[model samples]
Target chain A: MKHTVTLILLMLFFAVPAGVLVLISLASGWRFPDVWPAGFSFSGIALFLQQKEQILSSLASSFVFSLLTVGVTFFMCLVPAAVFARNDFRGKTVLEGLLLTPALVPPMTFAMGLHFFFIKLSLADTLPGVVLILAIFSYPYMFRALVAGFQTMGEHYRICARNLGAGPFSILWQVELPLLMPAVVAGGSVVFLVAFSEYFLVFLIGGGRVASFTGLLMPLLSSSNRSLAALLTLIFLLLPVGLFFILDLSLMRSFRKKGMA
Target chain B: MSWTNNRAGRLVSGLAPLLLPYLVLFCGGIMLTICQSFGVFTPLPHAGAALDAYAKILTDPAFFSSFGFSLGVAMVSAFCTMAAGTFLAYQVWQLPAKLATAALIYKIPLILPHISVAFVVLVFWSPSGIVASIAHSLGIIQTMQDFPNILYSGWGLGMVLAYTLKGTPFAMLLVLALLVRFDVRQIQTAAMLGASGVRIFFSIVLPRMAPAMHTSFIILFLYGFGAFDIPFVLGESRPGMLSIHVYNLYFKHDLARRPEAMAILTMMFFFAVIFIIAYSKTVQRLENGVRKL
Candidate 1:
């Protein structure tokens, strides 16, 4: 009984805020507290659809940047993670720790200088530059996930595969890559989310040229224009929700199939 | 032998395309930032040899105040995130698996942007917001007219709590992720031995959760300290947070003060680095002590 009650309380806790977000998203004119939206309409939906070009562009930028972030981070994490995994190399611990240092710096500082660095490099306010910065921020997640994943599988499979005259390429492509896909996806998903929602680097570095969902959505934050922010919030919420939902469903299905066997 | 060798070579070579772009994009920013922190921000990104930027940023009273405010909010909100997250995690653990699904749903807050989170919080709580709206309807006061802006007031902690709320879902999600792999039988055995719920928790649950909790605390705090979004929209200008200071330093307030802005950001670097180090050590010690227990 206590367990059930506690569960209900947790439900109520999340439900209230979630309820508010949904209510505000659907309701027109922002009146509150009669236990539901006073006058619900699809007008917010209509309005957002009306602004679909701007919204679609922002959404496109978010996806493209995130895709690049994932690809870049996954590859970037490889050399260091492989080094740490494949050897008892000197300074491995120090180097591995240092690789994660980007997470420890203030983003504002990074953004301030990165914007400048881009100008010097002739990549300022460019799509590629923003993509690079976003990837930098997400490197730690992909690196950690990849490193941890690599460490888990013992060297036994590789040894056997090698004895069978399989080269390093075959072993990795056929054996390692297949197993690493889940971690790659997990790490990639995290990187994608980080890049997708990034507000600072895009705003400060892109100098308003970028139209990331977060960047476009940030301007309306405390004004009557907030309905726009709220709309984007639903979109932002959807990205993660959809990814995790699909991932979770597939994982559960796989597990259930395995169990039935 | 030829086939095997070719595949091995293929894997290593195929990696170059992915690795090269990442090195330039991701690692490049990190390298650039560290160097710029030392340079005088002659033209924002162009670092001059003189270290005058760091000097001025360290010396300025206004810069120092913002740094202090950011640190204070980060630490306070991190503590709140930990406390609230832990309590909620405990409740979630006690529930059945299906109910835990509802608990997991609480984490939707983790995905919302800081701006949107702050906006909702503003309406629901600000004097002219939802709370004040209700306050007016109840005849608590004449109009919702004069309600103080929660954004900048003695209710300073309100912003901190909102930030904490912004993060608690994340902290809880990370903690719950760790907890799912935990061995529950030991705790049950302790309960069987007549251990009080609190005692069993302090002895068993927390000790096991130490690493994840510490990590959650540090990451959440680092974000809180370095956060540009929440505090920008929610905090008052009277006590600027470091992230905000770093921002307007380079962009808004004075275009000439780039060096000072860079210096203040360097100071933020110290806070972010130091707290994370302290957090890792704390987690290590807790893990060791738990092993001993």
Candidate 2:
């Protein structure tokens, strides 16, 4: 009985808003004093379809930028995480904390300064600039995840590989990379989400020249087009969730194939 | 050079590639913000004193109100999110393995964007929104306008609702992570000894869950305090969130007022630093006390 109640409550908590979103997306003439939408239509979906080129472009750009951010962040975090994980040094905790401050503090605090600097370097309004900034701001999540991954992994594997006359690159490529897959996926998921969902940072750096789905969606969310906003919001939710699902499936497959699961 | 010194040098050099990007981007970005806040590095030269922007912002009542309002919204939302999340998590944790697996749905909101959560709140809670429509049909509200204006009520209820919606799943994730490692035999043993559910919870379970709760509270609080997406979607004009204020000061105003925006950002960063120190210290103290118990 208790389990049933918990299920019901959880369903209500999630499904109610979800149902409302679907209804709002379909409602053509929803108004007050009506419990149900007076009429339903595909106008919102049709409108989205009509703007397919623009929406698809924005989606593709967001995807490419986020993918690039994940790749750059993974590369950047690799040596640092190895250094931190394999060795302890003076002021390590403080340094780690300082490195993590970007995640804690509002990005707006530093974005303005970065904006001016990017413009000075002529990096503003460019795709690589957007990717670089996103990578910088979002790398901490990857850093922390990788550090935890390394800590759990311990130094034994590296030492054993070295003892076997394996080069550092070979050990890293062959042994450590496979072992670190879980951490990479975990970190990459968060980095992707952060970069993908980010709005203000992308808007500030991209300067409207580098289009993002968020840039396309945020203004419409505030507009009076409730149906369209709801439709686009669904799309926004779809992208990251869909990406994570695919990542999860592929990672699971690889782990199973490698007998690591 | 000594062998140890040479090894250390090599390590430092190895780390330089990673640290260089961070130092240049993160640290450099903050340094530039500070400089501009002091009117040092700006697009246009400033003839006024370095502290003029600070003085102007410090004297403004709007700044204080926005700060207080942000604090209130963040605190309330974080508290509520944690409360609901803790209860739900405890309940879910008590379920059988089959039911627990089904309960993975709790994480749905965690995958949604803050902006999407904001829209969900707006769609459900606005005056003419779904809840209001239901209320009208049920004769609880006479008309659409008669529905309480929760979104634009100036108390930031809209932002709070959105934050809670976004944060609850996060709190659940953190708490559940800890709970999964917890052994359930202690609760069973206590129950067998005639300990009441509430007593077992407070004496045994709550202590175990405290660390997760505290960590989630801090993370969720800081996030709610500083996040821009939800507030941008749900916030009102008057007494806006600090993020909105910074946006206006930077984008809406002319280049001359850039210092003021940077000043707000600098103060915000300072506040975040102070908050981290205080919160972590307090959590440490609490943990130590619990350990002594």
Candidate 3:
């Protein structure tokens, strides 16, 4: 009974807004003093269809930068995570904490300065610049995850691979990576989400030259057009949520194949 | 000694690639912000004292109001999220395994962006929104305007609601992670020892959940303080969030005022550092060496 109450309340809190969003997407004129939407129409979805090219291009742009961010963060964190996992030194904790500070502090603190530096280096208003800034801010998630992954896998695997005459590159590629899939997915998921949902940094760095879903959606959201805002929001939610669903299934299948399910 | 020296050298070389970027980007970025805050590296030339920007911001009542408003929103939302998250996580942990698994719907909000969450709050809480409609239909209000103004109430109630809605799921995820490894038998044993529910919760459950709670609180608090998406959608202009303040200063204004904007950023960065240090120390002293997360 208690569980049932909790479930209902949780649904009310989390799911009802989604249901309302769907309703608003179809709502033609939902005015005050009405318990339900006054009427429904496909106008919102039709508008989306009308702007298909723009929406798709924005989607593709968001996808490209987010994927690049994840890839860059993965490589950047790889050697550092391994080193930190295997070795201990003075100030390890302090360094780790410092490394994680980017995740904790507001991006506004450093973003303005970085903006100046990027312009000087001729990286502003470019996709690679956006990817680099996103990776810098979001890589800590990947780093922390990989560190935990290495901690879990332990050094025994590395020793065994070395004893079997596997070189460092082969051991990293064949031995470590296969075992670190879960961590990679975990970390990569966060990096993807952070990069995908990020608006200010992308807008600042992309400088209106790069089209992004968020850049398109944020302005529409602030407008009084509930129907249009709702439709775009649905699209915004679908992309990363869709990605995570695929990720979860693949991770599950891999675990099953490894008989670790 | 020589062998150890070689190992250290290898470690240093291995770490150099990562540390180089960290130093250049993260550390260099902060150094640049400080320099610009003092009017050193701005595009506009200035012959004023280095402390000019700092003095201007310090004397402005607008800055303090924004700062206080942001602090209030962050603290309130974070506290509510942690409290609600702890209660719900405890309840979920007590459920049978299958039901507990089904309760993963809480992760739904974890997937939504702050902007989307802001939209959700706006759609439901605005004067002529769903809540007002419902209230009017239920005879609680004669018209939509009779519903209390929440989104633009000047107290940042809308931002708080959105942040809490978004942050609760995150807090739950963190707290639930700790609960998964927790031994349920302890709760059962306490119950068998004639301990009351409240006592068991306060003494047994809370202490175990402290690490996740503290971490989530700091994370959510800082995020709420610094985030721009929700406030952009739901915030007002008079006493804006510091992020909104910075946005106006950097983008809306001319290049001459960039140093003042940078000064605010530098101060916020220092405050973040101080917050982390004080929070960590307080948690450490309270827990006395118990670290779960």
Candidate 4:
């Protein structure tokens, strides 16, 4: 009885929403008093294919900026993450907390201010500007993940590398980077998801100049085209899930090959 | 002294990469917002006093209504998310190993973007939506139009539903992280005692979950309060979310009212900061007092 209750609850919460989305995406003129969609049609999928070029370009743009944000955040957080992990300076807690505030506070609060600054610097409405803003907003996740990564890694590797006459640069490249891959992936996934899904920040900074998947989808979402909106949302769900699945598989394979799993 | 100085320099240089952008972007942006709120960095020259924007915002009854409405929606949604998440997590945790693994389905919503979740809510709950359709077919409602206009009923219930939908999994993730380490033996022992199930949950389990509950509450509550995406899709315009308010003032209105937008953002930033401080302090005090009890 208990198990049955749990299963029912799980299905209600998890399966129902997804099932509704799938049904809506395929339904033609699905309307009131129809317990199910009126009839299945290829209209949504047809529309997606018809506008494939524009849709694909926006997807690619979102992908590129999100990946660039990940790269920028990785670089920004690497040394600082190491410093934070290894040291216990005065006011360290306060400083770390302060740095992590971006993650906690609403981006809308500071984004307007940054928009003004970006406009002054000619960074607004540029791809680099979008990447920079996203990186700035999201680097804290990478910072925290890397700090944990470095702590788990410990100082022993660096010390051993120095004993072997390796310089700091070589040690970081050859030794620390491989072990930190998991942390990077973890952090990068979050940063990617955030950047990919963000609508307002890109809209504000890009000034309609930037092509983003979210930008393309936001207007359509509110339109009368329910089928198309549902189709695009499904695609939005699929891309990240597919990427993470592949990532997880490859990480597992690599770990197994290295006898680390 | 030289050794310490060198160490200090190394630390500073090491942190510079992260600190540079943070200072220039995050701190600088906030400083600019505060300055703009005071009529210092307006697009056009401002002749008014520094506090004029603040005075304007404080005087406008719309601002207070929006603020109160945002607070209410956030609080209600966050509470619902926490309650549902905690209950579901406990259930999932108690399941047998295989069934528990199946319950991992709850994390699906966590992967979904906020906008997508809002879309999901729209697809499911709008007047002509799935639930209403089902109800109409089942004779529960005479017509689809007879379905309650729950989405735009002006109480922000639609936004609450959306937030709770998106947030419950997040709350579950946090709670389950702590729950995985919790020994089942404690529960068995408590059950062996004369304690009722409710008593056991409140006494033994609830305390263990309290820290995670508090943390997730702060995060979820603040997110619901300040987030734009969910509110954008589901929010009513009159006395809309504060984020929407800021967006309208900044973008929709003229450049002259930029300070007013900045003022709202400035107030939100301060409110978030104070909320965090006060919340942590209150939690700390309550926890200490509980320990004494």
Candidate 5:
């Protein structure tokens, strides 16, 4: 009983930052020295809703970038994993080592290099430029997960998939994909979260012309209208979590209907 | 065989769009920046080739200080984090099976936003922050104002502490992942064969853990070296950490010397990649050694 109470309390504590942010977003004021916000309001909510267009555009960019990242990550791990699982290649060990290299390197430093390159290519200030710089550069965890999935899923599944008279596309869509989904979902979130919260590269490469949520928050941080910043933080932070939940639900439900879940 | 080839081709075709973007991102972008570092920062940058940028940046006294400071703090923090993280992981590892879910709960900070982390550090470590408040209440300090201003001291010790707190759970999580798959039966048998717990751990578990520890150290070091948030909000403005300095050169200064900054960034990237390669090799070597043993 004691352990159960402690566990529940600990879980509650774990969720406080996000919960506080949500409360602040809903509340009209959260002045310092108060244990809680003064009260809740929808007046400020309307103003935030008014900023929806700007938010939507940035959100759209975030989605597109995330999709591009997930796609790249899936394949980068897929090819080598396929090769490695089937038969040995020369320098196989070295290629395996090289594949994991992206995860070990610091992102900001990598971002800096990409920023420089993008500037030279005249892509530095554009979405494609940011995409080229930011997408799938450092995601070793994803590689580890996907490669393990592909290797372990093996030749038998493919043969079985073929024997079912399932076309290659159908086999991939129906068979390999279901097995890979958990790895992809798990890997995808790690990459997506890192990219979403990523500060240096996006800011530098985007060159202030591209106003991301984090980028937009930069000016207000100097002033720190605590209530407002907290509200903005809540909203900005939840956007990713919210999208992820919706995706998870839809994916799970779709899979469940198809008896894949 | 044709069907297999056809299927493989389809897989490749399906995968191409995803793979191509990363190639352009990582390879093209990185090499371009590295090459641009040699180029003069013409507004066009197409004017090309400036040894001057490299020479001038290398010659800057402040640049060297910042670089050393960044590297040194990272080293200090990484070492400290490894110790604390190992201890914490051990403590968590000893938990009852029923409380395994609760053990995972102790690791909330690993998933906590970096901004919240910065905020927490600010709130706790500021002289007018939590520590000061506690000391004042204890009569150890007359006022919060009289308490030490650890955050902006330029020594980066406080910032490193904050970084360690933010980083420890992550290191611990990685350690936990390794420990989950670990075979403990032999270690127990060794304990039954008259080995002390400490000896079994040092001889058996530590070697088993070396690769993951090395990977963790590299990750912690990289994170510290390129840490932008904790340092940005906490470090003194004049202290000139490398990332901070590069940022200033780009945005605040808005100079044509972006290429100069790029030169430093390229050096950073080179060292980072070298470290990654070395760490990966060490892990591979350790894995092979373990397998052989």
Candidate 6:
């Protein structure tokens, strides 16, 4: 009995939302008093194809910025993460907690002030500005992940590399980085998702000059065109899921090659 | 002493890449906000006193109402999401390994952006939405319009539902992380000792899950409180969320009201800090008291 109830709920929780989205995406004029969509058509798909350039460019822009954020955050967190993982120093705990504050406080709180500053610095409505704000907002996730990654990896590898007379850059690039792939991927995935799905930050700082998928999707969501909105939303959902799937697959394959799996 | 100074300098320089941006952006942004809140460095010249913005915001009934509404929505949604997540996670944990793996389907909502979740709620619960259509077909409602206005009932139920949907999976993920390491022997031993299922859950399982519950509650509550995405989609104009109010004043209003907007942001920043301190202290006290018991 318990199993049956859980199964039913599991279905309800996952299936209903996805099922509704699929139906709406294919639906043509699904109207009042209709239990199911009235007519399933390719009109939404047709419209999507027609506006493919605009939609796809926005998507590509979002993808590019999100990846750039991942890179920026990775660089930003690397040395600090190493320092944090290896060293015990004065005020370390307090400083670490303060660093993690961005994750806790809503981005909206600081975004306005950042927006004001960005404008003065001529970074507003620029791609770099969007990426910078996103990196600042999200680098904490990478910082935390890399700290854990370094802890799990321990001092042995770095010590071994040093004893082998490896320079710092060489050790970081060749020895440590290869082992740190999983952590980077894990942290990068999160940073990517946070950056990709972000609506307000991109919209405000981008000021509509910078194109983003969320920027394109937000207005369509509230509009009367349900099918197109549904279609775009599915794309929004699938992109990250696809990226994670590929990431997991490649990580597994590489780990298996190294006999680490 | 020179060697020690050199080591310290190296440490500081090593951390400079991360610290530089953080200090320059996060701390800098906050400092700028405080300054602007005091009617300094705003877009326009402030001829008024430093406290003018605070006075206007504090005296306004709408600001208070918005604050209250945001608080109520956040608290209620966080509680509901936590309850549902804990219960469901417990259930999943109890399932057979094969089935438990399948139950990972619950995480579908986690990858979804907040706005997408809002879209899902809007698509399902609106008057002309799928739920209403189903009700009409089933004779529960005579017409689609006869369906209740669940989305815009003036209670922020739409935002609550959206938050719960998006947050439940997150809560489950956190709890399940802890639960995966939990020993089943404790529950088995309790069960054998003639404890009812409810008693075992409350006594044994509840304590195990408490840390995650508190963490997720704070997280989801704060996100719901200050987050603009979900609210922007589901929120009403009158008595809007605090984030929405700030957004409007910052963007939609005149340049002079920027100080007022900054004032609200500064207040929220302090509130968040106090909330974390107060919450952790209270949790610490409660835990210590429980240990004594």
Query: Which candidate leads in lDDT?
Result: 6
Ranking, lDDT, top scorer first: 6, 4, 3, 2, 1, 5
Query: B1-293, model 2: which lDDT tens digit per residue?
Result: 56447767867776776789888988899899999999988989987999999999999999999999989999999899998888888888888988887887777777777888888888789888888988887889887778888999999999989888888888887778778877888889999999998999899988788777887788788888887888888988888899999999899999999999999999988888887775555456554745564
List of clashing residue pairs for candidate 3: none
Residue pairs that clash (backbone atoms under 3 angstroms), model 2:
none
Can you write out model 3's per-residue Cα lDDT over B3-121, one digit (the tens) per residue? 54697777877777678778888888889999999999898897789999999999999999999999999999999999888888888878798887678778777877788888899
Q: Global lDDT of each model?
A: 0.71, 0.86, 0.87, 0.88, 0.67, 0.88
Q: Rank the candidates by DockQ, best first.
A: 3, 4, 6, 2, 1, 5
Question: Model 1 chain B — which ten-residue stretch has the worst lDDT?
Answer: B10-19
> Which residue pairs clash in candidate 6?
none
Docking quality tier of model 3? medium
**Which candidate do you rate higher for lDDT, 3 or 6?**
6
lDDT of 5 by residue, A20-128 (tens): 5566557775443334556888755676577768766776676676566666666666655555556654675776675565555556655665665566678877877
Candidate 1 per-residue lDDT over residues A99-175, each given as its tens digit: 56675566665666667768888776788888777777778888888877777765777889999999999998877
Task: Give the RMSD in angstroms, all C-alphas superposed, for model 4.
Answer: 2.6
lDDT tens digits, residue span B119-189, model 1:
76775776656666666667665555566556667335666867777788777877777677777899889
Model 4 C-alpha lDDT per residue in residues B1-293, reported as the tens digit of each score: 46546878889888999999999889988999999999997888877999999999999999999999999999999999999999998888888987877897887788777888898898889998888988887889997668899999989989999999999988888788778878788889989987898998999888888777887888889889898999888889877999999989998998989999999999999989877775555456544644553
Off by over 4 Å in 6: B1-7, B278-293
Report the C-alpha lDDT of model 5 over B1-293, residue by residue, as the tens digit: 46546755655454455346546655555666676677733344544446767788889888888899999888988978776676566556656787876666555555544655565566456675555766766778886568777877778867687677767777777677677767878788998899997898788877766666776788899878876766776666656567788777766665567677777877888888878777767778766855665
TM-score of chain B of each: 0.80, 0.92, 0.93, 0.92, 0.87, 0.92
lDDT of 3 by residue, A1-261 (tens): 888898888888888898889899999877887768889999888888998999999989999999999999999999889999989998877777788888888887887888999999989999999998898899999998999999999999999999999999999998999899999999999899889888888999899888888888888886766788888777777777788889889889988998978
Model 4: per-residue Cα lDDT at residue A145: 91
Native contacts conserved, per model: 0.47, 0.63, 0.64, 0.65, 0.34, 0.65
Q: Candidate 5: misplaced stretches above 4 Å?
A: A1-64, A75-81, A84-87, A106-122, A231-261, B1-23, B40-50, B190-203, B254-256, B289-293
Q: State the TM-score, rounded to 2 decimals, of chain A in model 5.
A: 0.81
**Sorted by TM-score, highest first, which candidate order results?**
3, 6, 4, 2, 1, 5
